[model samples]
Target: MHIVITGANRGIGKTLAGRYRAQGHDVTGTARDGSAEVVLDVTDTGHHADMAAQLGDQPVDLLICNAGVYLDKAERIDGYPAEMWAQTFAANVTGVFLTVQSLLPNLRASQGKIAILSSQMASHTRAPGGSYIYRASKAAALNLGRNLAADLRGDGIAVGIYHPGWVQTDMGGAAAAITVDEAADGLVDRFAALSLDTSGCFETYEGQPHDY
Candidate 1:
């Protein structure tokens, strides 16, 4: 399978890229710093265009929209700045949409599946008052994935939104519950299980359905 993973320089994206490559799949790992096969800053339209052009006619069997930001983490109620919200939304919500749009042709050629790494924090039921920007952006991403699933089903494309668990990554912190390998392993299985019949599902890395 030809897989495309954004934000692959580090964290879960990096681990997922390595795992897929170790499995002998063709993996295009993209990073903003050009540390991977492709250079992409998810919020940049030019980068998205360049990435699409570089792939040409190659079919992308899987597109993982793993790039995101959590700018307002732990911000006090009055500390949430407007710019933080803008940046967070740009990366977490608009970026996912742009990546999917840019790769639509390639995905269509392969009848691919899209896996969006959202978070349990995106669920309304999980709201705990912190990281408002991150939570809102992820929720928007979930909504985007669901609608994309509906629109792309006719093209044999499936979309699934996932909560990758509390992973031990730069974003998730070392104290987080799961190791990168555990999260990646479970996510790989979840990605493989995604199909038109189960498209638009919001699920955990462990393959359990999550509340919307």
Candidate 2:
């Protein structure tokens, strides 16, 4: 499959890129800087245009919106700054939208799938009160993916939102549950299982149904 992943310089995104490539799938991985085959800073609309130009009508089978930020890791109520909220939303929410929007034509041509890497924190049932920005951003992403699924179903494009399982990555830290490869592998399987019938699903890395 011809796949595109964002924020692939390290962590789960990086691992997924390598695994997919090793399995003989064509993978275009992007980073904020010029560090991959596609130097796509997801929030940058110009970069999205550049990426589309680079692909130049190449059909994409799968697009993984994996680029995100967790800036409000442990912010107090008064400590949550305004700029922090803006930056976090830009990377986590708007970035996903831009990538998907820029690649719509290619996805439509291929009848493809989109996998949004959201978090368990995105769920309203799991609100623990900390990391307000990250939680809110992820929730917005989940909402975005669901609505996109509804709108794009007629175009034969499927969209799914997933929690990558609190992986042991730079963002997840050392004490997290799973390794990047494990999470990536599970997510790859999840992506493969995505379809028009199951579009807008919110699932875990292991394929379990998640409450939204």
Q: lDDT at 98 for candidate 1?
A: 96
Candidate 1 lDDT trough over 10 residues, lowest sum:
69-78
Q: What number of backbone clashes does candidate 1 have, counting pairs of residues 3 or more apart or in separate chains?
A: 0
Q: Model 1 residue 2 lDDT?
A: 99
Instruction: Provide TM-scores for the models.
Output: 0.99, 0.98
Q: Model 2: runs farther than 4 Å from truth?
A: none
RMSD of each: 0.7, 0.7
- In candidate 2, what are the lDDT values of residues 39-80, reduced to their tens digit? 988878999999999999999999999999998887888898
Reference-based TM-score, model 2: 0.98
Model 1, position 37: C-alpha lDDT score? 91
lDDT of 1 by residue, 1-212 (tens): 99999999998999999999999999999999999999999999999999999999999999999998887767998899989999999999999999999999999999999999999999999987888888999999999999999999999999999999999988998899999999999999999999999999999999899999
> Lowest summed lDDT over 10 consecutive residues: which window, candidate 2?
32-41
Deviation from native of the Cα of residue 169 in model 1, angstroms: 0.6
